[model samples]
Target: MRKYWFKVEGLMFKERPFCYLKFRHFIMIVVLGCFLLTNGELSSVIEIEARIPQKNDLFSNGKMDSYDSLENRKLLLFIIDFNDFMCLSCLDSFLDFYYCLPSDFQKHLSWGILVFNISEKEGNNNISARIVEKKLRGFVAANNIKFPILIDKFHVFNGLAEEGTVVMVFDWNRKMVKRYVFPLNKGQIEEIFKFLTE
Candidate 1:
């Protein structure tokens, strides 16, 4: 009878390390799921899939090469909202990818960036069209950016001068194929380049 009681207590009350770990992970996943659903804006920014254009025979055309105009060339438009480039984690991702871009591919892509600023209760002109471009050049040079990061003082998302930036990738076909919202890992950049190269 004592053995039976001891077994019951051990099984019922003892902390199992594996089980505890599993329970903690489950709780985290649930909390993350709840957070993603509750906060619509952050959730949208957290994960995004861009629209990829369908490949056609014209994809092999010479218009995709280095000789093409910057506007006609494939473009990677990265819109950045953070005013301070040094302290931002997103800046790290941008620098990593910018440096990783192969020379041959870099010339043809014609990368451009639009820097934006968030506003307080001010009436208008939250982000000076001039300041935004200047900040962009600083980041581009500091990070050894080989591509041009154009300034968009007016944050044109939907409404005029909307905040936050989105990364847009244009294919050789002169179509805006994809827009990357969140910062990406190295593998993601590789895949994007690979898609364009092919």
Candidate 2:
């Protein structure tokens, strides 16, 4: 091994023979680390999946409905906490977008609302199924929602994704292709419509 003496600001240092290669390797490692970190974060954001509840207990419009009914069609599901004002507002916005679609375009998609976080005991609020049903019926009647409003009594779909309001788009194969949080913007709506039309 050869030692090369170098001086900087009157301070002397000795460099090893492969010092330049060592510096290059350090730079490469830092760059690779950064790439992996960024890729991981982006993947987490883009690849969120909704775990569909597979029980027969899901209630829709006073009738029991299973998730199998949603198969074989492009489905748009709104997972909402009905108690949240923001979720309610977002639901209203989504309904507006849904109703404004042309008849032919609308026929290509199936929509449903999954109401969660209501029946689960939260602090002092232990809501019963009867009360939950009454409130949901009122909401459906007030909003004139024709699509199925699913009551998740068992919390089957909870903890599958981030809490609060989410819009999940599933293909005919039941693969969740995209998920949008909160309100739908114009671009998001366009993307959803495009996916459904295809």
Candidate 3:
């Protein structure tokens, strides 16, 4: 009886130690996965968003790349896709964010008010690209926007997304932070600006 009891205790210790190690490994995998996706874009039930994609571009030549977006693991990508830049409310919202951003923000990451265009004229017409660029410039000049404007015409290459100004923030790895369905108020804008720039 004494020998049987000792054998049972020894077996229990060996199995228990293996179980704990296996559980620890499982937890580590989950944590690592979350960490990896933390920096790139993500989708909720409704919208898709990424940061301005300024830093990831690296070239800084005003080239529009919806694919090579910013890898900001911590920063939210404020992608405002204005269907009509002429819209009064949209312009105001854009300006509100523009004026609210910190002046020294460029030092840390790449950022710009991306002005992407989706049109119907179909068939590889690089003209829309140029047109949107001109229109964006015009809009900037007319409104006196301090922030830069980028023409994200990759829809021509890939396909068009939904209409409306969508703002998305990505962390260092392009993971989404949060998105605004309605135009942000002064307080919300300031709060986000403070968090991102600081």
Candidate 4:
């Protein structure tokens, strides 16, 4: 067997045998492959091909639009049940994250809040769709939200996630990449920022 040597500055270091180096590299590759597989599985909570409704009634601005209209931009849809208090709080945090993004990043991103009110049976009364739309409009106005306010009158997005509030990120090709529930933590936010900047 022959030995290999490496010099760095004034120091000389003995290198491992070729066979040993090959075995080590093989082990490292296996470990890295496993890590990537596991990370990919854990990162994507749900995969969806969400199609935005084209009806003007579905939009708070009363404009008919389709998902095709958002071409060439990554989309971030905040699906929230407006009746839930926790969801409302999460929306505020989401808005904070959105506001902190640089203007250039914001320009490349197409984001909107898909607001829906799930009617719960309270005695003999149930919230009407008209009332829900009115309330959602007020909420958007009070917050001064400039992004599209998608009104889900028929609970179209309610089944997208188990949580009352969810943040779904879609690539430019309209494939859902990530789904986050509740308020986004620092690490999650950082990951999203990385995606947006990419």
Please name the candidate that would achieve the greatest TM-score relative to the true structure: 4
* Cα lDDT listed for each candidate: 0.54, 0.56, 0.52, 0.57
lDDT for 53 (candidate 3): 45
Which model is ahead, 3 or 4, in terms of TM-score? 4
lDDT of 3 by residue, 1-198 (tens): 999998887787677988767777999988877875775222111111223545444335555445445333343334555565657676576566656555533322324444454456654447756765676666666765543344554442122225455455545443436655336776767666655754
Q: Which of the predicted structures, 2 or 4, would earn the higher TM-score when compared with the native?
A: 4
Worst 10 residues of 3 by lDDT: 40-49
Two-way TM-score contest, 1 vs 4, winner = 4
Candidate 4 lDDT, tens digit per residue, 1-198?
123232441132124466566777999989988996766221211112234443322233435357666454565677766655334665677667767776633332444445554446532223455565566667666765545555565455668745756777776554547887767789989888776667
Lowest-scoring 10 consecutive residues by lDDT in candidate 4? 40-49
Considering every candidate listed, which one attains the maximal lDDT?
4
Candidate 2 per-residue lDDT, tens place, 35-115, comes to 967652211111122334334323345454566865655666766565543346646766677676655333323344445
Positional deviation of 79 in candidate 1, in angstroms?
2.2
Global lDDT of model 2: 0.56
TM-scores of all predicted structures: 0.49, 0.50, 0.47, 0.52
Which sequence of candidate numbers ranks them by lDDT, best first? 4, 2, 1, 3
Per-model root-mean-square deviation over C-alphas: 15.5, 15.2, 15.2, 18.3
Clash totals, every prediction: 1, 0, 26, 0
TM-score of 2: 0.50
Candidate 2: residue 113 lDDT (0-100): 48
